[model samples]
Structures are given as structure tokens and as C-alpha cells.
Target: MSKYLFKSRLTPDGMKGLLSEGAKARREAVGRMVEDLGGRVEAMYWAFGDEDVYVTAELPGNTSAAAMGMVVSSVGGVRTTTVVLLSADEIDEAVRQEVHYRPPGG
Candidate 1:
């Protein structure tokens, strides 16, 4: 499984729906959504910013992550951005991979 950070901005309809739902109800709904994606929501928060909600979760893979993001965004009630989170070991492994590249004007 891989970790991810999900940032979401509520659409007008989403905002209205949130206003009508209680905090517990929202949490339950989010939990169910993550379960449906075969993932677990580790943390979630409602924030005051360009993005309304932030979520941390562990999903099966990139495909699962993309699928979840697509489904949520298609609802027209929220726009989401999913970023894959890597651990220190993963970063170290990535750093070992070689790629042909050059700096600008090098």
C-alpha cells in the first residue's frame, strides 16, 4: 500500500451539502468513501483556505488513487488533488535510479 495526501475544494453544491450535514455524518460518509476505494482514511480535516478539506490515506496503488480522485471529482460537488506520499526508504531508492538529464545551458 502507498500513502497519499488528498486536498479537496468544495464546489457550491458540496458546500451546501456540508452545511446540511453534521460533523459525525460527514466523517462516516468519508470513511465509507475510502472503504469503497479499498483504502483507509487515516486523517481528515475541514480547513479554511482555497481547499476546504485535506485527507491522508493509504491506498493500494496509483491506479486506485486515480480512480478514487476521478470518482470524487466527477460528482461535481468537489475538486480533488491526490499526491502520492513516499517514505524515506522509498526516496532513497528513488535517488539511486539513474536518468539521463542535463541542467539548462549545461
Candidate 2:
């Protein structure tokens, strides 16, 4: 499984739904959506900023993540930006691999 961080902003319609449904209900709904995709929600938070919600989840893979994002956005109530999360060890492994590259003016 791969982890992902989803930053979401609710549209005017979404905000109305949230106000009607309540925060907990919305969170639970998000959790259920993730579970339906063979994933689990790790953490979720409501924030005040460019994004209204932040959700960390473990998903089956990139394709699943993309599908989830697409479905949510297509609803027209929310917009999402997904970031693939990697563990420290994953970064260590990444740095261990190398590629040849040239700077613009090297």
C-alpha cells in the first residue's frame, strides 16, 4: 500500500452540504470512500486556509489514489490535490539510486 495526503477545498455546494451534514459525518463519509477503494484513512483534519480539509490515507496504489481523487472532484463539491507520501527509508532508497544529469550551464 502507498500513502497519500489529500488537500481538499469544498465548493459552495459542498460547504452547504457540510453545514447540513456536520463535520463528523463528512469525515466518516470520506473514510468510507477510502475503505471502498481498498484503502484506509490514517488521519483527517479540518483546517482554516487554502484548503478546508487534509486527509492522510493508505491506498492500494497510485491508480487507486487517482481514481479516488477523480471521483471526489467529479462530484463538483470538492477539489483535491494529492501528494504521494514516502517514508524516511523510501527517501533513503531514492537517494541511493543515481542518474546522470547536466545543469543548464554546467
Judged by lDDT, which candidate is best?
2
TM-score of predicted structure 2: 0.95
Worst 10 residues of 1 by lDDT: 22-31
| Whole-model lDDT, model 2 | 0.97
Which residue pairs in candidate 1 have backbone atoms (N, alpha carbon, C) closer than 3 angstroms, thus clashing?
none
Q: What is the per-residue lDDT of model 1 for residues 1-106, given as tens digits with 9 covering 90 to 100?
A: 8999999999999988888996568778888988887889999999998899999999889998999899989999899999999999999999999989999999
Which lDDT value does model 2 have at 89? 92
Best by TM-score: 2
Instruction: Compose the digit string of candidate 2's lDDT tens values, residues 36-75.
Output: 9999999999999999999999999999999999999999
Relative to the true structure, how large is the alpha-carbon lDDT of every model?
0.90, 0.97
For candidate 1, give the lDDT of residue 10: 92
What TM-score would every model get versus the actual structure? 0.90, 0.95
